[model samples]
Target chain A: MEPPRALLFDVFGTCVDWRSSIIREGEALGRRLGLGTVDWAAVADAWRALYQPQMETVRSGARPWVTLDVLHREALDRVLADAGLQGVPESDRADFTLAWHRLDPWPDTVAGLHRLGQRFVVAPNSNGHIALMVNLSKRAGLRWDAILGAELARAYKPQPEVYLRGVEALGLVPSQVMMVAAHNVDLVAAAACGLRTAFVPRPTEHGAGQTTDLRPARPVDVVATDLGDLAGQLGA
Target chain B: MEPPRALLFDVFGTCVDWRSSIIREGEALGRRLGLGTVDWAAVADAWRALYQPQMETVRSGARPWVTLDVLHREALDRVLADAGLQGVPESDRADFTLAWHRLDPWPDTVAGLHRLGQRFVVAPNSNGHIALMVNLSKRAGLRWDAILGAELARAYKPQPEVYLRGVEALGLVPSQVMMVAAHNVDLVAAAACGLRTAFVPRPTEHGAGQTTDLRPARPVDVVATDLGDLAGQLGA
Candidate 1:
């Protein structure tokens, strides 16, 4: 089959190396605070653990719509308190939460994106709001044909509206747009919405002992080792 | 005062020389149809003139929300019929309506956006939906830091929600983002929503004999000859 006209990415670990980057930034903040011996990676993992539940409130209509930045900030505060890493100033916490906006892409992301951009429109179908996506794109030099996804739907990923509206925004039917992610769940959701799907496993997204999504847990149209391999497979 | 961190543009006439671009494309289509001696320029103006009233129907709840593409398509059919350019093929008519997507940016647009990209986050806060804006950006090389506007707000410009939500998506207060446009009406509405405004006149946007918005009709934070001047004045 021919390739889709646009590729929408589930960005956190699919495009950007969120785990290591967040840990590195968290550790630096811990060092500056003299909060010795903090498990920065663990903090990063724990903080991400809160992502789904926090978004659930909004999805369930228990809360007004809030962007991922707000979700991340609130999650960080609670995670820090629970981990007994309190006393980090609100200003520092705010800055630390912004680490999501400064993630480093996998070494292959930039070059692969450049190649793929020649063929298809590339954008982050991220839960990250437009601002976070903008900052991340600017910092990482990931040239997107457009910025799109969740904020436009006023909902989080896996919501039908998010994937539906994502394809709609591209002025294409879902079948003409592919949702590429490192996670099977995201692919599952997108496929259910009638979009094409690709899974590029980020085995170490949660570090060396990562259990989930070590491989494509379910069927997808394309499965590659990394974005570079994906680009090659897609003929970009 | 410090320049805003983000600049949201009005796309139709501000960044793109839509009149010339549309006229050129329309005349080509006209010739293809063997409809000799058609005044394509007037058709372009008449089509654009329908933009406000079309959007106003949605604004006033006279119709359900329809995207700019749909609105343009509807308006194009009416404009063609009125001009006696009837019975155009469905596919050809659809492609013609997308002339907005193929608009040529003003000569200064690419260079000025590049300059401004060094400092402020640049985006098109246009009534144009994400796809049209995305196509325009790729075709014209207008680098946008983000895309936010009518589609997200479910309304067209001049609606306070458009400006308010546009700013909110950037995670900034309205005052921290400038709305740059060639139309005084746009700046007036943006200002009413607390956004900083810049007026850059495109006196020839409606073709020769156009008289409105020859100068700033309302006080704007900056008035520049074009985007390049705006970039220079804003120190980007």
Candidate 2:
């Protein structure tokens, strides 16, 4: 098989451990708000659990497509209420909502990306809006050549359109690009569209209760321990 | 005055010394093709002289919007003929056409942008297409936050819609953006649409034959020696 000319990454749980970051940030916000002891980790897990169903609502045409920022905001409001954090001021809520933009990268992500970037065009194909992704990259030092977001497509991933649109924007054929992800579903979707796929397992992405994706579900171009290993495997 | 949250720069004369690079490259190519003792610098100047009128063709609706890549090709063809160069293969012409993608950045540009990027979002708002700009940035070490180009707007710069489209894509208000250029016309056009402006003197941009933009023609928010000075003036 021809080596991929570009690598499009799935950002959230794949590049960064969003669940733990969100829980930590939530715990701090909870303490500051005098909300008393709460299961911040559980809240983070629950909020992530809602992510798919919420997107499915839009994907299934039950609701209009909204940017991940808006989807995340809506999820935050609902989860806050469910967690019994009532009467939160709008300003405080806004702060909490932006926590997604500040998630720290996984240990191997930065150096690994820089190494891979030396060989290929590397970028995030995330549900995050362009502004959100740009800010996240700056804050986290993701070292992306460009940020490709759902906002540009007005559609979220695992949708074929997102992958196709991103490759087109890069002036690359889908076959010349690889989709790198921790999630099998995202890789599968991209593969179906003729993009090469690389899977790096992130078993704890969903936190302590995480059960699946301890390893890649299928044979992919390069399955490795982490992004650094992936970079090595790709000869980058 | 409110500080612009983003700065969009003009690329050719503003960021890179395209004329000298092209002239040097052309001279080398001329020698390889046995076209000895040719005045390649004159050819470079003649090619650059076609820039504005070529873009003007698009701006004035005499031609549909074409990327700087296409315009470069047209200009190269005209200049090659004018210089009476013989037996230039199609492949050689294609390679020559890509010279725009390989132009070297000004000495201060990379470091200056690295400094300014620590504060304000910076990007190129160029007549080049996104692919051309992206490749050029990678090749030239230009540190743009995003690549905004005429292809995205389907119009050339100095067009209000082109300026406004960049603002909207950035999720910024017009006032929150600045146009930085070596040309007074570009800054004035951007200012007319309520964006802030900065002028950087590139008196040698057109070589010793330079006759315009010795300094800013109008009151711009900041004037500086080069990008490094601009970064210093912006307190980055």
Candidate 3:
């Protein structure tokens, strides 16, 4: 197989452990607000669950455009109410919403990406808007050649344009670019758009025993254990 | 004065020594074509001279929008004919055009940007499109937080949207972003859009004895010798 010229990444579960980071940030927010003994992990999981449905509103044209940060804020409000964690201060709620921007990288992410960047042009094909991506990269030390994804496409992933715009930003054809993600479904969507695909399994992406995306559910160009392994496979 | 959240750069002469690099690349192309001893410096100067008028056509709507790469190619064709250096091979001309992507950074660029990145998000606000910016950053070892500018705005600089879109990409208010440019005229446009401005004059940008942009042509928020000096003044 021909090596891809640019590698577009799925940020949340693939590059960073979003579930764990969200739970940690939720716990910290709980501590700071003196809201003792809340179910932070459950809240995190609920919030993650809401990701698609909220985005679907925008995708289906039921709602007007809003940045991912805005969507996360709305989801956070619903999650907090569902968890019966009432009276969360507005400023505290806002701070908690920004936790998404502070997600921690998986152990091998930084080194592996720097290695891959030496060869393939690398950028995030995330649900993240450019500002969110920039702030997240700064906080997490995930160096990127550019920030692209939902914001650039004005549409979410699994939509063809997201994958296409990611390739366009790199000034390469879809065949010349690869989409790397922890989710097999993302790879499926990318493959449909003619992008090369790399699947890196993060079995514990949702606090272990994550049933979905345990393996490549469909054909992919490359499959590796994690980003570092993928980088090794790519000869980066 | 309050330091800005992001620093947007003017790339060509400000960050990289385009004149010498273009001359060198031209010389190499001339030698490879068995047309040695061609006046490379003159060619470089003539090429640089066409920059503004070429962009002005697009800005004036006399021509449809094209990426800077396309504009550069057209300018190259004209400069070659004007210099009586016609009949260059297509592949060689194409390769020579890509010399823009391989331009070398000034001595203090990388280090100064690294220092600046420690405190603020830094990205180019040049007219170069995404691919050109990406290749140039990779080649020059520039660690930009995100790529932004002409392509993002779909318009060239001195256009209000170009400066506005750059600030928007960082999720920053215009007041919270500073335009750091070697040319004061660039700062003037940026400042008109309510962005803070910093001036770092490159007296030798157009080869020694260059007359234009030799000083801050108008009032600016800060003035420094080079990027390092600017970073120092910003306390980065």
> Across residues B86-162, which tens digit of lDDT does each residue of candidate 3 receive?
98989988889899999999999999999999999999999998899999999999999999999888888899999
**Stronger candidate by DockQ (1 vs 2):** 1
Q: Which residue pairs show collisions in model 3?
A: none
Which residue pairs of candidate 2 clash?
none
- Per-residue lDDT tens digits for candidate 1, residues A93-122, read 999999999999999899988888877888
lDDT of each: 0.90, 0.84, 0.90
lDDT tens digits by residue: candidate 2, B1-236:
66779998999889998888888788777777777788878888898889888989998999887777789888888878887875787788888888878888888999988888889888788888876777778888887777775866889978888888787767689899988899998999999988899999788888886899988888988998999999888888
lDDT for position B13 in model 2 = 89
**Candidate 1 — which pairs collide?**
none
- Full candidate order by lDDT, most accurate first: 3, 1, 2
Say which prediction, candidate 1 or candidate 2, comes out ahead on TM-score: 1
Residue B99 in candidate 1, Cα distance off native in Å: 1.6
Best by DockQ: 3
- The CAPRI quality class of candidate 1 comes to medium
Model 2 CAPRI quality: acceptable
Indicate the worst ten consecutive residues by lDDT in candidate 1 chain B: B143-152
How much does candidate 2 score in TM-score? 0.91
